[model samples]
Target: MERTLSSDLAFENNSAAQASMPLRALSTLMLWQRRLSSRRQLARLDSRLLADAGISESQRYEELGKPFWR
Candidate 1:
């Protein structure tokens, strides 16, 4: 004879939310790198391309002026 248990189902662990600090820091660093790369690309966009993306020159300037950490 065998018996089934339901108590274990109530103890699910949230592993993702408990990620290690190094992993978290790596993800944050990647985000900053992406921001820097994107800003560089935005800085190189021509006036026509900027207008097509619905971004004005002043708006591009503001975004490009921001620090990568931001």
Candidate 2:
């Protein structure tokens, strides 16, 4: 009975993890997508807007050069 209970607990833990894995992956993907979109927008900003945002040309270039994961 004790062994059965232990196995049941383990199964529940594994099931929960499995269910959450895809959700976590989707969340990560969405986060990267947003980052990429924002970076692209940043790269397209005019000098005036960039200045307004306090971002220098070098800083914009540096940010644009980074991967979304970074």
Candidate 3:
């Protein structure tokens, strides 16, 4: 009976962990999507707009190609 109880507890913990994994994955995906969108939007801007942002045209191109620093 004690072994069964422990097994049930373990199962519950595992289930909760599994449920959280997908939420974490979804959040990560959303973050990446936002970053990519921002990068694309920045890339679409003309040189004048980039200059206004104080970002060099060449730098913008580099940043747009690789948005994530980490």
Candidate 4:
């Protein structure tokens, strides 16, 4: 009986973890998309806008060069 209960608990935990994987992947994808979009917009900003945002060209370049995952 104990063994059966343990197996059932393990199964439930595994199922819950599996269900969460898709949510995690979706969140990661959305995060990457937002990062990429913002980087593109930043790249398009003029010097005045960048200065207003307190970001230098070199800083912008560094941020723009980073992969979305970073």
Candidate 5:
């Protein structure tokens, strides 16, 4: 009975660890998605709007290309 209890505890610990891996990966993906979307939105602005935002066209392109760098 003691051996069975130990095995059960080990199984539960492994299961919990496995479950957490996906959640961590998913949150990382979501963060990257948000960054990429923000970069795309900023890239969509016209040169005048970009100028108002103090971002040059070259800077906008650089930001768009590295959306996930942040």
Candidate 6:
């Protein structure tokens, strides 16, 4: 009975771990997608808008140059 209970617990733990993997990947992908979208929007900003946001053209260019993964 004890061995059976322990095995059941181990299996449950393994299942939880496996289930979390896809969630973690999805979270990362969403984060990267958001970053990409934000960068694209930033690229569309006019000079006045950039200044209003307190971001310089150089800073915007630098940020745009970065990969979404970063």
Q: Estimate each model's TM-score.
A: 0.72, 0.88, 0.68, 0.91, 0.61, 0.83
Per-model root-mean-square deviation over C-alphas: 5.4, 2.4, 3.8, 2.1, 4.3, 2.8
Please count the clashing residue pairs in each candidate, in the order shown. Answer: 0, 0, 0, 0, 0, 0
The window of 10 residues in a row where model 3 has the poorest summed lDDT is 1-10
- State how far residue 63 of model 1 sits from its true place (Å): 0.3
Candidate 5 at residue 15, lDDT? Answer: 99
Error of 6 at 60 (Å): 0.5
The 10-residue segment with the lowest total lDDT in model 6: 1-10
> Largest TM-score belongs to which candidate?
4
lDDT of 6 by residue, 21-62 (tens): 999999999999999999999999999999999999999999
How large an RMSD does model 5 have?
4.3
Best by lDDT: 6
Winner by TM-score between candidate 6 and candidate 3: 6
At residue 20, give the lDDT of candidate 1: 65
Cα displacement (Å) at residue 9, model 6 = 2.1
Q: Model 4 misses residue 38 by how many Å?
A: 0.2
What does candidate 2 score on TM?
0.88
- Per-residue lDDT tens digits of candidate 5, residues 1-70? 3544578898999999999999999999999999988887997799889989999988888888774947
Task: Report lDDT (Cα) of residue 65, candidate 3.
Answer: 71
| Off by more than 4 A, model 2 | 1-5
Instruction: Give me the overall lDDT of model 5.
Output: 0.86
User: Candidate 4: where is the Cα deviation over 4 Å?
Assistant: 1-5
Which residue runs of candidate 5 sit more than 4 Å off their true CA positions?
1-16, 67-70
TM-score of decoy 4: 0.91
State how far residue 62 of model 4 sits from its true place (Å).
Answer: 0.3
lDDT of 3 by residue, 1-70 (tens): 3534578898999999999999999988888888888888987898889889999987877787774633
- Model 2 C-alpha lDDT per residue in residues 1-70, reported as the tens digit of each score: 3534578898999999999999999999999999999999998899999999999999999999998998
lDDT of 1 at 56: 98
